[model samples]
Target: MEDLLGSYIIFLILLFVETKGIPPVTLAIIILNMFIFLSPALGVGEVCLSVSTTLYGCEWQRLALAPLHHIDLDHLGFNMASLVWKGSRLERRIGSARFTFSICSFGLLTGLTYLLIKATLSFLLSDRFNLDCAVGFSGILFALKVINNGHSCDGNIPGPFHIKKRDACWAELVLIHLLSPRSSFVGHLAGILVGLAYVMGPLRMMINWITGKETSSVRFAECCQLSRNGHPDRDSDGDCQSTCLPRHRRQRRRC
Candidate 1:
């Protein structure tokens, strides 16, 4: 309960600094999660992520929904805090449409990764790992963290452990699992693996192909120009070239 309250405080602080209020993609996700958490009618537990249940019982919808479900208030709180940071930043850095597709794909892939690893371990170890379920948005957060840091310098992250900014999220995943026995160690590890796969794998290409969307490189460049020129207001028509300098001049300035 205390942790949940602290998360709310942190969330409010994040809202203050965020250039844009909650991006639509992130807002929709938060609302969905809140509804699931507050309404006993939702029954997230019945569909939570469990390897045995997923494979044997064939509850495939759990793969998509489990990441939205939290184990408890603290679990939900911590994940939401991370979500506000990573979601807002990444969604802004890339367009909101891309950000939504990326997270949805990551969540699905993360669940698949966990299921595969659990099945392998169960087959080889013969009763070592538990068939119990896992649930949280932490996996998607880790993937977003990887994507965010992959694109920019994340700066010196403050911590006693002193991990590099790019590597801090991975370190935090390990630390969180180690500190809390009840936390899903395998689930978090699966998230990291899935994150790596999403960044390095052809999943991105597949996304582009399916969505028929071009890379955000040009859009991002235009947005930077708009901000630099003190015209941060985005045109509702979606054309970023509004009130912007010519391409050659912008290139020359860069050179």
Candidate 2:
């Protein structure tokens, strides 16, 4: 019990410090999730993502707020840790505007995915559908994890069984599901689908429109490289125009 308490204490301290230099949207998301989880007395749980309530009763707002609530300390801590690790890097790579847009799009879709599945199951199995009252930011974490792994070049992710970088997201999905019983499997699976949709489907086009940045192919590389050189701003044409660039070389070459 003492160890558990200590873990929570440490998590709180780390969360406080982790916001430093984090992309604005990412930091705000972490703060919002933490605040809502710690303030359950405010009746945040009623807005939790519920398939039955959302679909049958038409409480659509729950889909937006549900990911911000958590079942317990462990669930919250695990999801937050993953968010900090993957979200911070992805936000830096894609820029805050695109990152925020992606999070909103992905979060809603994940809830909708769960809703679709539950509705189908209900129809197929009448009285036997288990309406899992899912909550927490795991779905977004999973979505961000998929995006991060796709853009990362840090080689393989180290673990009990070493896995290649490209395959790490799937490995994590499987492993975390096996370890975290409280986590919603369908929600995380939906997050994966959303990530893939963004990468391969029309969602990518929407993100590009939202941020005015090309998110498809070369933009990830350009964003990471330019940010590394301390140039977060891009030109109207979506090319790096950092003040750090030489006057003659600003448009033609890297800083």
- Report the C-alpha lDDT of model 1 over 1-255, residue by residue, as the tens digit: 666656776775677466457788887787778678767454656877876789878989889878878877878777876787788877775688888788888898889888888888888886444376888898788888776655442245666766765687678787887798888777887878776765574776787787765445433333334356655434442334333435424564641
lDDT of 1 at 139: 77
For candidate 1, list the clashing residue pairs, or say none: none
Clashes of each: 0, 0
Model 2 regions lying over 4 Å from their true place: 1-20, 41-45, 159-162, 215-255
Give the lowest summed-lDDT range of ten residues in model 1.
Answer: 217-226
Q: What clash count does candidate 2 reach?
A: 0
Output the worst ten-in-a-row residue range by lDDT, candidate 2: 215-224
Error in Å for residue 61 of model 2: 0.8
Alpha-carbon runs more than 4 Å astray in model 1: 1-20, 42-44, 128-130, 154-156, 159-162, 217-255
